[model samples]
Target: MNTPSAGTRWIQLGLGLIVMMTISSPQYVWTLFVKPFQATTGSGLPAVQVTFTLLIVLQTFFSPAQGWLIERFSAKGMIALGAALSGAGWAAASQIDSLYGLYATYGVLCGLGTGIVYVGIIGLMVRWFPERRGFAAGVVAAGYGMGAIATTFPISDMIAASGYRHALLVFGAILGVVGFIAALGLRPPQLGETPEIPADKVASAARDVPPKTMLKTPLFWLMFAMMAMMSTGGLMVVAQFAAFSKEFGVADALVFGFAALPFALTFDRVTNGLTRPFFGWVSDNVGRENTMAFAFALEACAIALLLAFRENAYAFALLSGVVFFAWGEIFSLFPSTLTDTFGTKHATTNYGFLYMAQGVGSLLGGPFAAMIHDAAGSWVPVFCIAIGLDLVTAALAWFVLKPARRAYLGVPVPAVPALAEPLAAKPLAA
Candidate 1:
């Protein structure tokens, strides 16, 4: 098999970015739809919110199977199928009259669709840029993180102008078509294709560890727990921000001449997008665990500040962006670290198992967080729980994840040299 030129790989990256961006609004812009759905269905907040949890759970829990399918089939075809499902899910959702219908359409269909494109593209990016795994992954992850920024206000306006149903139908078709067209152009790098990197920058793993072998490793499970914990904190904010903002009487307040909720949401999206690449680049040079520790700790602090001053609109908006900026890098850091540790041969499948942690996080972060707020009659306990989880995860990233990964790979602290080192030149075991 022939390896494509750098230019060709970059083009593939661009297409993956487009596909990711198109599908991302479904997740990120979901908060905007929550109130509308609840009003339309007359379901309480917790019941309406369960759809969000269902979406994430299905999207994440089925990723390993989705990854396996992508690996065994045409990447383009699988992505196209996913795009169709995602778009159709939204379109179908616009006509649903009940929560169960919403779950079937938006939760199950869109979840499965996004899962397929997400894992397939990440795997493709990892394969295409073996030497720049973090950056490549970050670039694509940014599309998912920030994609909704372009549409959030538009959807909000459409909901206000026409209705949620109309907004869903129009955007669903556009995103689906765009995603499908872009997916049609995606091609995974040929097997055994490797990018050239400096000898000192090779990853620690000497050979690809099959997914089965990776599943049994303590390193993988520890990383899974870490990912879940980090995910819970971030996702809690993502799914519940609008609710909290409303409860605090700041949702409609003005921040810098813009509505506080939309302004904060847009700002959060930008910071969220920027953090993926920024931290991914940082991880490439400084080390993944170090970057994780820094970003996670920053998130913990931001959450605490938000809880302290949340009633103030300006503080709420600013701190929300900070919280997201600190949180979003997990999307980039985890995948790069996983591929770095386990090898890229089975990256799509291996990351699938790890990605399930996001589903677990969603269960904890989405519905559970909402339930906590309801039970306590305040967002205070929710914020406190999130803060504690963030701090604990940050500590574990450095103290536990770092040392365990080093021992698993038999490398020293700060394992930068091994990633770019020539595969055949190293004596490390698979």
Candidate 2:
């Protein structure tokens, strides 16, 4: 089999992005339909929240299966199926009159579809762009976030013009068709069975550690914790931004929805893609520890601004940009950190396990924020919790990750890539 050239890899990246745009786009911009969905169904806030909570739960519940499915059918077949399920679920959801119907169709069926496609793109991108995994992963993942800017208005308009059910059917059909087309373009690298070259001239060594042994390592636990902390706060914001804005005195909820504009979405995509290479390379050169520590610190600051100074719209927008950047960058950096530490022999499976951390984090985060808001009448405590978690993560990254990267690189603590005085580490950015 002929290997895809670098240009072909870029094409795969575009297809992966399109899949993200079609299926994974709705999660962040869910706020757009909350009011309308509630109005149509006569449901309360908790009921509405439960629907989305159910969506996250179902999506997370199926993560392992999705990962396993990717390995079995490969990326193309699985994501094509995902696209069909997602579109069909949403379209069916639009016609539902009861909460239960919505739950099964939108929450479970659609969630399952999302899980399958979402796993495929990430695993596919990392394998395809072995030379630039972080940047490639970032570019693919950024589609999920940026997609909202394009879909939000149209989806909202569809709901308004044709009602929610029609909107769902239309969107679902479009997603299904597009997904099928893109799936045809998906293919794994054709590198045969050759092992990757080492990052240094010292020669690449393979890990003899079994999966169970690697899981038992303290580094695995720490990285899981890091991913969870970085994600929960961001997802909380994504899930609740509509309600949060209303509480914070923004009269127009659509303004918040429309904030998913080209500028905002482009910022999200560009920063996320840029940061992957920037920080991954930095992690390669400066050490994953220092890069993560810096990311954690920056994220903490962004959370602080959201909590303390969001009374102003401009301030909120500025902080939103920071939040998106941090969110995108953190997502990109962790995989690079993992592959750097663990090597790539079983990269897909290992990354899939770590990806479960995001699911756990989102599971805990979405409802927790709502429950807190129900109790406290503000997002203040939620923001505080996120900030505190980030600070602890920063400390952990500073100490634990630095040492782990050393062990993985087979170097002394003082000689870790980021810590070495001469800092002449190899560039993994490109």
Candidate 3:
């Protein structure tokens, strides 16, 4: 296969973004459907919420197999199949009357579909933009993080007007079609080829490290632990935001003339999307561990404040956005960092293992957190656990991840090259 030009690679990136955006709403807009599903099915909160856990678990845990499939099959074909499954999942759920039906359709099918699109796109981005893995991954990840902003209110309104069934059918078809078309446009970078970069550009890794080798590294496991910790907190919020908002007595309150819940969800999506690229760019310049520590610490603070002042409508909205902003960077940070450390030869499959941390996180954050709230009669203990995880993860990023990566790289810490530096004839292996 011929190498794609920079322009062509960027166009592919744009297509990946659209694919990601279309598939994102299933995960992000789920909270909006919780109450409606509960009312319709007459299920308890815990039983109804298990679908969310199932959604995240299958989405993440199956990613490695999905990633391996992408490597062995046609990227376009796999993505098309994924899109179809994702759309059909939601559309089929509209007809289901039982929780098991939901688990079969929305939980299983949507999870598998989203996982395929996510892994495929992230893999494509790192290959196309090895010189700026963080930024490239961030741009696509932003699509997933921010995609729901455009649909949250619309879904809410639809659920209110036509009921959740109609909303699911309409949006599911739209997402499936759009995602299918976009997936057709995606192409992987040529094997054994790297994008040309300036000689002075900061190289992420000296050479490619196979997935097996990467798994053997202690650094990978440490990063995994940190990612799981971070994911637990953010996902707890994502899965339970609506419940907590109502619990705090601010779900119906107004913020800036808009209902607080939707307003916060929208605002959180924006900050969530923005932080990926913002911190990705920062990491490309400042270093990964430094960025991780900063973002995680910010999340720790935000979650604490959110718990403390959640009853206040304004504080609830603002602090929720802050928490997401800090937390969402993990999507960009961990993937880029993994590729940076392990190299991109098996990025899709390698990152798949790491992505399972999110599955672990979903288990901890979703049903487990909900169970905690039920037992405690408060969200306070859950929030405290998240805060503690954040602070500990932040510390590990600096003290553990930083030194570990350097030792693995066998180099002293080095500064990123300035943009003014001349372009190199050969590209970096990362």
Candidate 4:
């Protein structure tokens, strides 16, 4: 095979971002399907919400194995398979008559499909952009966050027009096809493509640490806890935005001639997508921990204010957008930080373990939050709990994650061993 040029990585990055975008609507716009699902099955809120939880839970919980499979095979092949499955899952969901079938099709198939593309893309980016890991990870993750923007209004309109089944069947196929086409160009980095850093260097903390060893570190567990909390607040909003909007009496209210629910969802998608790359770029220069503190603190404040201004359609629309802005950065921040600490060789599988936090979060944020709402007849307690998680996780990032990562990386390289050598080692770039 010919040597991969330096500029080729950019092309790969673009393709990865496209794939991420294609897989995104299944997760991001799921709230749009919640009510339709409930009406069709005559199921209650908590029960309907289980589909959302299972989608995320399966996506995240099985990711370690998915990552390993991607690593062992070709990213291009795995992604194509994943895209097909995800798209078909949605289309199949259009024909399902019962709740269990929804769990198997929309929940299980979509979850596993998206999980492969997600983990595969993240790993591919880190390998290709060793020097700009934060930016690379952020950009692809931004695609996932932002992708639903293109579908939110259309799907809402579709459901209003022909019903949810037609919407799911049509758009599901579109998303899958687009992702499959984009993934044709994606694969592992060429041997000489990634620059190498000395394991002992304090500035460039690059070493190929395996997944098994990484799991034993206290540092890794701290990250898991922090990620779980951050994922909780954001996911609660994603899965329940429509539910709470109706409950708070803002769903049908107008905020610039658009219904508040779809409008808020649209705005939230934009901010959520933009924050990943923006914060990732900032972290590249100012440092990751500081960015985490600032972003997490903002998320906590935004959530608190969103609840306070919940009654006002304008506040609900805008503040909810701000809430997402702060929350979405975790996708970029955690992956980059993990790569910084654990090394690039096993970025996919290691992040898979960390990504399970999102599954933990989906449970806490989805059915559990809905159960709280059904019992209390309010969303206030759920918001309060989410706020608490954001605040505590933010503090942990500033006080715990930052120092722990630094101290752990500070250890002498001689104490550590590489799981596998770089494909080709070269001196670090200045």
Best by TM-score: 1
- The TM-score between candidate 3 and the true structure equals 0.89
Candidate 1 vs candidate 4: which has greater TM-score? Answer: 1
Ranking by TM-score: 1, 3, 4, 2
TM-score of 4: 0.86
Give the TM-scores of the predictions, in the order they appear. Answer: 0.89, 0.84, 0.89, 0.86
lDDT comparing candidate 4 with the true structure: 0.83
**What C-alpha lDDT do the candidate models reach, one value each?**
0.86, 0.68, 0.85, 0.83
lDDT of candidate 2 over 164-219, digit per residue (tens): 77777787788778877887788777665222433541211245333465688887
lDDT per residue, candidate 1, 1-430, as tens digits?
A: 2456658899998999999998898888888899888987889988987777677877899999999998888889998999889999999999998989988988888999999999989988988877777888999999998888788889999999999999999999999999999999988776555565444553557678989999999889988998999889888887789899999999999999999998997788889999988988878776788788888999999999999998999999999999999998888899988998888788998888889998888878977898988899998998888889999988998789877776676665544534322322243653
Q: After superposition, how far is residue 73 of candidate 2 from its true place, in Å?
A: 3.0
Q: Which residue pairs clash within candidate 1?
A: 201-420, 202-418, 202-419, 202-420, 202-421, 203-418, 203-419, 203-420
Off by over 4 Å in 3: 1-6, 35-45, 157-163, 191-194, 197-202, 374-376, 413-430
Q: Highest lDDT among the candidates is held by which one?
A: 1
lDDT by residue (1-430, candidate 3, tens digit) is 2445558888988998999999889888888888878887889988988887788888899998998898889878898888888988999989898989888998999999999989888988988887777898999999998888788889889988999999999999999998998899888877545565444443466678777778887888999999999999777777789899999999999999999998997898899999998888887766778888899999999999999898999999999999988998999999998987777778888888899999898888877888999999998888898899999999998778876776676545446633222222232333
Q: Give the lDDT of residue 218 in candidate 3.
A: 86
* Model 4 spans with C-alpha error above 4 angstroms: 1-6, 32-48, 156-166, 195-204, 371-378, 411-430
